[model samples]
Target: MSLVLGCNISTFDSTTAPADLFNAVRDQAIAAEEAGFDVVTIGDHLYATPGAPDEPTLEAYTTLAALASCTNSIQLSTMVTSNTFRNPAVLAKMVTSLDVISGSRAVLGIGAGWFEPEHDGYGLEFDAVSERMAKFEEALRIIVPMLRGERPTMDGRWYRVHEAINEPRVRDDLPVMVGGGGERRTFAYAARYADHLNITCLPAQLPDKLRALEERCAEAGRDPRTLEVSFATPMVINEDGEKARQQVEEILVQSGVDASMASEVFFVGTPAEVTEQLRAKVLAHGVHRLMVNLFAAGQDLDVIALTGRTLAPLVSGG
Candidate 1:
């Protein structure tokens, strides 16, 4: 199969009125659809991170539901939702609702809860990584079956869904993509449960990550190829390669990553060069899909449209 091209609007844009941001995002997604991008994703967060200068962030589901009405072709999804943010049963129902509205164009991209600040700020349970993984495992048990129109009965320690009915499911084959790189637990879960695995790692680390995922699939008695894999990295494409490299540094520094690690982390170059880099660094290692966060390009519609029109054909051979 051809590469699956997905875009994410990361939480890095300037502060703006909520309505204006929503409109801008809607227009961006519409433009992505028109430009032949397969999916449009949003970061799942309660509020903007790095609160020094306010960043305009919205609740993922609400924003996605709104975008579902505004766009026709591009699939709507969370880059990955925090498993602790909502009840899994309710989360499944939410995806079902979106699927009904978007004509079966919704995918559940979820992960173990990570941001401690959001959990503390919102007064939600921010358990340790072990406990969080426990919760994530239990949540998926409920979510997966419920989305397939099954009333799940789970009496787990972390989350309990007592035969909850998931109504209005449009697609029985609704895609469930698990995101993370924990070789032991997360990859095991993905091998067992997920239809897709969105690998969040630096480009250079992809080969090892894919190998680890394959090992986990073997342990789970599943063929690794059964699960689709996608790499999530920042896209920093510019006409001038040096400009792209500089912006990549800025983006990395803003995210608390060392500036020195910027070169191996983002797709920094012109469109053709970026595609060539991805093909060598990521795709050759066996990842066929790329989920790029549109941050270096200011999350603007024009840049996103350009990314789709320019880079997508290189992989799809269109």
Candidate 2:
């Protein structure tokens, strides 16, 4: 598989309007497509803070509806939808509908819900972590079949659905990607069900995480290679490596990342530098897909455009 670049539109302030966010997504998707990116993805969060503003939380599926209409080639998906927010059968229908509208370009990336504050504010149950995992597993059991055109019926401890048929059945085999890094539970769920497995980028912890995933895949009688392993990192690109690092540092300051450790966590540098680092990580860790989250919201569109025009091609082997 070739390199993939996906930008996650995460707003750090509530000042951005939903319409503006949608327009940025449209423009960015077009730019990414024109720049030769293989996928355009988004993160799912229903919360508001300085780090995540925009009230009423621009629902992911609604944004996806607009995204489906705006872009043709780029695959659209959430980085990971929290399982606790929506009913599984309902969530399945939403994505399958997007698949239908997008001509089968939708992928579902889901996770056990985190962010207890969002749950509490939204009046949703903020279950214990263990219970959340069970709910997540139950969600997969209910969602996968429904999207595959099966009229699913399920009676589980946390959820109950009967003979639910997702209409306008997904136009293709919709990919289900589960996101997390829990050695025992998350990887096991992905090994058993996910088409792609995503984890946060923490280079120090990645080796052990992949090892755990490998073991889980073995226990599930599945080839770990059959599942795509992906990581998300923030990228700062410019002609000069140090200049790019400075740009990333500025963004990190805006995001309130600790001044000392921010640069170490992000991919901040020139295209060649980022590419060299990515190549090393990919080869060393067996990572096949990489999605870089561009924190360019309320920043320079020129930078975003340069990101696609310059970095996308370099990393995509064009």
Candidate 3:
């Protein structure tokens, strides 16, 4: 089967990011489009995590807006937006606006807010994991209908929207992508509302995640094939095998870890080796789309281009 592949420019903790942040991401988007990636995405976060507090991070939707004007053809999206970051109605309108600006190339990828530090830092609502998941479920109840140009009225426990209107939606089929591999809420939401599910599991765990997703779809009485599955993980590649292994070792060492543990989530190799691992771990497991995070190398555009070029041709749809 043909595959759908996308590159992520998520700067979650990339401290050595480019001095010109916007231009770097924009150039990455342009290069991704040229290299045949289906889409380019960024993480949605106000405060940095794991990395230093002062590390550069661009707000997700704003960056997408900028990328929309500067590039053409590539779909623009947040790999997964936090549901609590904006009010449900406001979130729906924001994505619709993005679709309008990008000429129908927007995918609203959202998740239950997990980073409590970011919530505390921004003074936004921070609930327990269960509560956040519940609110996220309700948010989808509002967002899905609103994106379809409907006037939805929901008296949700965490949110209430009455006859909310989102107009000027470019297409009736604009896709909503659900991120995270939660067996409970995220899976249910993907079965009910999302067109895609970006599984946040390590490559080795993908097969199990796919089965859980299918189970969720069955419980929802929805067709499982309707929801596309994408594996989300860090992809680090280099032309030299030794250099690639060194990069992996450096990351592991700096983080005070060992190579064996890091290898589960990080893919570091020459293009050919990367392709082999992806094929064996992801594609062989029946997942067809890959949302690879390649920003750990800072704003090195050549790395992005090489990674994209090597894999895109093999994964592109007809």
CA lDDT of each prediction against the hidden true structure = 0.82, 0.74, 0.82
Pairs of residues at least 3 apart in sequence or in different chains that clash in candidate 2? none
Ranking of candidates on lDDT, top first: 1, 3, 2
Give the least accurate 10-residue stretch of model 1, judged by summed lDDT: 47-56
TM per prediction = 0.95, 0.89, 0.93
Q: What is the per-residue lDDT of model 1 for residues 1-318, given as tens digits with 9 covering 90 to 100?
A: 222888887665465566577777787788888878798898898766544334677889999999999988778899789999998988999999999988888999999978888788889999889999999999999999998878989788977878898887776889999999888899999998999998888777788888899899999999887888888867877777888788788877877989898767777788889888877887787666888886737466667777887767765742
Error of 1 at 172 (Å): 1.0
| Lowest-sum lDDT 10-residue window in model 3 | 11-20
Alpha-carbon RMSD, candidate 1: 1.9
Runs with alpha carbons beyond 4 Å of true place in candidate 2: 1-3, 12-19, 49-57, 170-172, 254-256, 297-301, 309-318
Candidate 3: list runs displaced more than 4 Å.
1-3, 12-19, 252-259
Residue 15 in candidate 2 has what lDDT?
55
Candidate 2 lDDT over 1-318, as tens digits, reads: 222566565543245575576675677667766665667766677874325443535577788778888887888888778899898988998899888889888889899978887788779998999999999999999998887788878889988999997888645468888888788999999999888888774666778888888899999999987888777766777767777777667767766877577546776677677777766655466664667676653144555666666556544442
TM-score of 3: 0.93
